[model samples]
Target: MATLLHIDSSALPQGSASRDVTAVFRKTWEEQHPEGTVVYRDLAANPLPHISATALSVGSVDPAEFTAEQRAAHDLRVELAEELERADAVLIGTPMYNFTIPSSLKAWLDQVIIMGRTAGEKPSAAGTPVTVVASRGGSYAPGTPRESFEFVTTYLEKVLTGMLGLEVDFIVPELTLAATVPAMAELVGKSEASRAKADEEAVTKAKALVARLAG
Candidate 1:
């Protein structure tokens, strides 16, 4: 059975487009792989601390020389890396904040990006499939005025694919705030269309992943 590492970093508990889309994907994954296991992490609920100088040196420094705080930080990083390393696939629900991913999600990514474990030579998570549900409050697609401000998916693609060598797929729902923001009322139809497409892609891709990995 396949194991999935599911992570959500939306600070908003409700009305989060990324969370909603990822839930659809997760449900489809469960239906297709009933015996599969999912290791869930809510980064909003339990945010990881930013990597400190000591934490950054954990891989190179001898464990025997670690201070109490450093050891604790190192342990958390190890756990995060192991979770990713063991998963057959990864799912991340990230909402754009200030034109990029929420800091909560970035913290989680920092934790799992172990030097020797996920990067460097002989990387353990090199070939894992990572599905990212990236939701934006406003339109940032090509041709949109805010397209240049879109750093969420672009940054993630660079890190997850270029750095760690993961196969990353994106399901983007744009103009998420249009549903409730009066100023964006004119874009509501387009927003709904984007969400619908994201939903459909989530289900289709989830099923395809299951078939490819679990079959």
Candidate 2:
């Protein structure tokens, strides 16, 4: 059976656009692969510790020489790496926070991105498909005033594909706050359309990726 790692980093548990779209992706995947297994991680709720100097040095130092904290950190890193390695696909839900991904998600990335394991030349998780549902409070597409400020999708694509060697797909729901914000009233319709398109794409991509992996 196929295994999927599902991660959610949105602090807002309820009514989160990223979560909503990712739910669609996950549901579709489960339907297609009824015997598949899913591993879920809610980064916001159960946040990972940021990488410390000890964590960076854990690999170089002998296991017997490691401090208690370093040993624990190393263990967590290994667990996260194993989770990714076992999974055929990873689905991540993240909302843009301060023009980028949440700190919780960043910490999780730091933990899994090891020197010669998940990162470096010929990383272990190479070719693994990683689907990201990126929800943004404002529109940051090309030509938009905040386009340059958009770092969520770009940064993830770089780190997941370039660093960890995973194939990346992004499903973005832009202007998520337009419907609730008075100044963004005019963009509400656009936001809804964007979400609708994302919902459809999520299902299609989920099924396609799982089928390709199965074959």
Error of 2 at 93 (Å): 0.8
lDDT of 2 by residue, 1-215 (tens): 99999999999999999999999999999999999999999998899999899888889988998889989989999999999999999999999999999999999999999979889998999999999999999999999898999999999999999899999999999989998999999999999999999999999999998889899
What tens digits encode model 1's per-residue C-alpha lDDT throughout 1-215? 89999999999899889999999999999999999999999999888898788778777878898889889988998898889889999999999999898888888778778766788776788999999999998988899788899999999999998778899999999889997999999999999999999999999999999999956
Supply every candidate's count of residue pairs whose N, Cα or C atoms clash at under 3 angstroms.
Answer: 0, 0
Candidate 1 clash pair list: none
Model 1 residue 52 CA deviation (Å) reads 1.0
* TM-scores of the models, in the order given: 0.97, 0.98
Cα error of candidate 2 at position 97, Å: 0.6
